[model samples]
Target: MEQLIIQLISGAVGGNAAGSAMKNLSLGTLGNTIAGLVGGAGGGQLIALLGSGAALAGGGGDIMGMVTQAAGGAGGGAILTAIVGMIKSKMSS
Candidate 1:
């Protein structure tokens, strides 16, 4: 639970950062946040299933586990945000 919360927060931050960096791909704040949340959950689960985040899944309270989850969430959030932004831009074009 703690890991998940960490992931979500990290994801949101990542999404916003990406959005700000890529002006052409910037989703509004609300959209970025929503996408980040979804991506965070999915990414965390994927990492856990892949065994890289097994410690987090196992409910470990270690700092490393939290960091791993945060990394995964942030990457996922940025990737998803980019993809969505590209798609949106294309569709509008």
Candidate 2:
């Protein structure tokens, strides 16, 4: 639950950053946020699964672990948002 919240917040930030960086792919604040939230949650979960399966699998009970999780979530969110934005842009054109 806590991790989910962290991912969602990070995802929102990531989405906004991506949007600001690429005007052509910007989906507006609300659209970017929503897409980011979903992407973040999914990405966080995926990372957690992979992380748990790896040798580095040490529960996210530590600061570094938490940071890694947030970074993964944010990165995933940004990528997803950019992909979606590009698709939308292409479709509209």
User: Among these predicted structures, which one has the highest TM-score?
Assistant: 1
- Which parts of model 1 are misplaced by more than 4 Å? none
Residue-by-residue lDDT tens digits, candidate 1, 1-93: 787887788888778878888989989998888778777777776787898888878977877788888988888787788889899999999
lDDT of each: 0.83, 0.80
**Candidate 2: residue pairs that collide:** none
What's model 2's lDDT at 92? Answer: 100
Superposition error at 10 for model 2 (Å): 0.4
Off by over 4 Å in 2: 52-60
Q: Summing lDDT over every window of 10 consecutive residues in candidate 1, give the lowest-scoring window.
A: 37-46
Q: lDDT winner among the candidates?
A: 1
Against the hidden reference, what TM-scores do the models get?
0.94, 0.88
For candidate 2, lDDT tens digit of each residue in 1-93?
667777899888888888989999999999899888988887777888886322223443666667766886798789889999999999999
Q: List the residue pairs that clash in candidate 1.
A: none
